[model samples]
Target: MSADALTFDCIVVGSGHAGSCAALAARDSGCERVLIVEKSPPEWVGGNGYFTAGAHRTVHGGLQDLLPIVKNVTPEIAANIDLAPYTADEFTRDVMRLGDGRSHPDVVKALVDGSRDAVQWLAERVHVPFIFSFNRQAYLVNGRQVFWGGLALSVEGGGKGMIAADRAALAAAGVETWFSTAAIELVIDGDRVVGLQVSREGESITLRSRAVILACGGFEASKDLRAQYLGPDWQRAKVRGTPYNTGDGLALAQRIGARLTGDFAGCHSTCWDANAPDDRGDRVLSNQFTKSGYPLGLMLNAKGERFVDEGEDFRNYTYAKFGREIMSQPGGFAFQVWDSTTIPWLRKEEYADDVVERIWGDTIEELAAKLVEKGLEDKDAFVQTIRKYNEAVRAFQAERPEAEWDPAVKDGVSTQSSHLQLSLPKSNWALPVEQSPFLAVKVTCGITFTFGGLAIDPDTAGVLSDATGKPIPGLFCTGELVGGLFYRNYPGGSGLTGGTVFGRKAGREAAKLSGAAR
Candidate 1:
């Protein structure tokens, strides 16, 4: 391939979940020459999708409830996939609750409507076994097959099996896979996306296509971009994933007049050890809050003062606390403190290996020492803080009877309180940190995705021009690129679900346009 020229019916840039699905959808829809250009080699699965917890949301009830077509979805798929029974009104209300009045109603509705079909379609291609966990109200599909193998397989099938099946299916459909190829630019003709300029092993190639899909991902890895978008406060965030997602596609699209949506970015909150070095020496950890339950203890800055409500949605609170609050603090970091009772629960309950290690200290004193050793806190200040906290806890408990004692713990209970102590001790209240051998772990908030991206029409998933309020010709977007669609609040797991739902729409539409052109 040379930088001079190549041609295809459609070009999909980035091989993450969205790009892969778009590529497959184009080929499956009868485009003869579809190409998937991936920057990473085949061996390296894209980090974001691969490491995700794989939660998805779909609406249920309303007029669709009476449609036979909707009802006809297999029991297995329905059972595995939760239908939240959201009426259009209810759905809109829920989105609005999170979106804070900024969401595009049409796009929100489209996603709610399309999720069922998307799940069914993806399930049909992959052997997704539905598990009835978390009660009958919720459903769980085996995403590991999709994540590991790229296809659905029997219980015995591993990641290799799924990947082979997915690759084979694409190959059989004649979707060209160009691993180790990087898309450097979007070839634009006026306001329309015409092709892509790509590079591989020092070679540059221009692949012309009727449509280009910019699914390259957000700027989670770019420190400069993070500082610019998330404000100067983000200078302390730890980059948790791959270094490759530097917003190349986003930059190219913006340069070509693509409109941005939402604010600079969004983030997830959870416990991560600041001490552990990632493969790149970037100090960070994973976002696996569900497994850990919640950090039931108090979190404080270097000054050893309680900040945000520790019991807030462990996930969302992490974002609000670390991303917005703590990151802006004097030191740009914070520490989590808990008693001996909390350590065992944290170790057993939290899934992140880093968090478990951070649950050190037999007493509040030991915990303070550990934090000081980690260079997260000053020894004298931390010790004084704990002494004050212990005094507060004792005073609070004295004010209440033992029979009336309640740890006032929310989110999760410390192991000592739950396992060692039979009941909540008013003595353990989160007032002052006067406990002995306390445990503290340093943590920094890092970004996950840019909430702001190319603005698109909610109804059609087509990129919108800010000036004209019209769709960009021959262009469509999904995932993080569709902005204002989720302006203020996010429906749980809507990000990935939106990607699947709208990526399918974009692919099908692009394929239709390509076929019509032919």
Candidate 2:
């Protein structure tokens, strides 16, 4: 790298939610010249953020507090809804428990503490219009929509709109972004990062900058990396996001000896449509590839046996891990079986015809025969499993006539097997697949992002040196590259918000060092 290379105050890699936030925050923090380098063309510059449905898990002070941010909530709507506070303590506890205490406490604390303000902070800079998540976060009760879980609002029009908002803000802020430019290496000299080496349209270029924020993504899209870090057969897993997220930032950071953290093999996997393409689906038809109605049904492996306790917890907490369990099954797939009783109330994502593969039958034998025709399993085994499950549900129904079946919260509805021979038992909200028009939707394991990356100072979002565990000058990281915020598992909708929290922090802190020119 030459000493006379062109320099800027700050350079942000990638154009996803994190990168967009970082670039904006740097400019806001008084960085005179800010640049964002994205490997993808401008059309696909948003990375995985564009593929998401804009669900954000933030600690809120109930519906009353949410009225200001959520622009579409009418007075009538607010009056009919019931919501409670989601304090920082509750958010922190969930983060700790969500990862089984494997998550770094400092990072989790930052995420929880910065969450509520972070959403507002990003929205003000990007003009993101927030709206209530009526489909997945709410259930109809007494002619009113009641929101559950810790999630409340999402960016209007989902992730695509979010990207558009950020793009406009970037233009308004006079920030420059270079498309089709891939950062290959960090320009390190005497333990100080000075610039970046990038290849733009196959032409090499050296650009010097006081700070670099690496926020591209993780290794979920790389077959070789997935096999190496996540073990064998992981390459067969479907990608739920952008194919361009092939760990460019993680590789660049590792080249500089950034200390890695979090569970390397862990990821945010989910039950996705088995017939979906290997890469992500169309941005216009996003959220169609994810099928999340498993809580209302039974998931059987290839051998026609239930493999997990679907009702062990709410879908928000359990779906992230169940997808990984499905990959561990006999054929790397699972079938979500339901009946007419539970089908009508199923999540709207299940009805996306282009992305989902569904089967139906009026009788258990007919359903099993249909599955056998697909080369799945023997008809006898499927019938026996269904019969045993039906018996248990009926027994429970007879014993507990007062049980209230609620979907928003964990209702006490469950099954009771008198035989006690069932290998996998449903813990809560269990209903038998005995009604006419039995339905089954096939789904495979789909990974979102890996939970491993370099460790960073949670306060400043600076990448820590592996040799001394000290902050590396001019090296900051956000998005998926800053690990220890997530570990074995994660809560749904936290990924994007986590990126916002650290991205803004990284941009501000990185900009603070921009005054120290070489």
Model 1 lDDT, residue 432, Cα = 39
The number of the candidate with the highest lDDT is 2
Q: Give the per-residue lDDT digits (tens) of candidate 2, residues 75-168.
A: 9888888777889888887778888888898999888888888888866767887888888788887888877777777878788888888889
Tens digits of per-residue lDDT, candidate 1, 274-387, equal: 553432223122333222222445666776555655544323213322445556655766777766554444433233454445556665556666666555556567666555
Local lDDT at 351 for model 2: 60
Error in Å for residue 219 of model 1: 1.6
Which residue pairs in candidate 2 collide?
none
- Estimate the lDDT of model 2: 0.84
lDDT for 108 in candidate 2 is 92
After superposing candidate 1 on the true structure, give the runs of residues whose Cα lies further than 4 Å from its correct spot: 1-5, 60-95, 128-173, 265-271, 276-295, 314-321, 340-356, 376-439, 487-491, 516-518
The number of clashing residue pairs in model 2 is: 0
Worst 10 residues of 2 by lDDT: 416-425
TM-score leader: 2
Q: Residue 437 lDDT in model 2?
A: 92
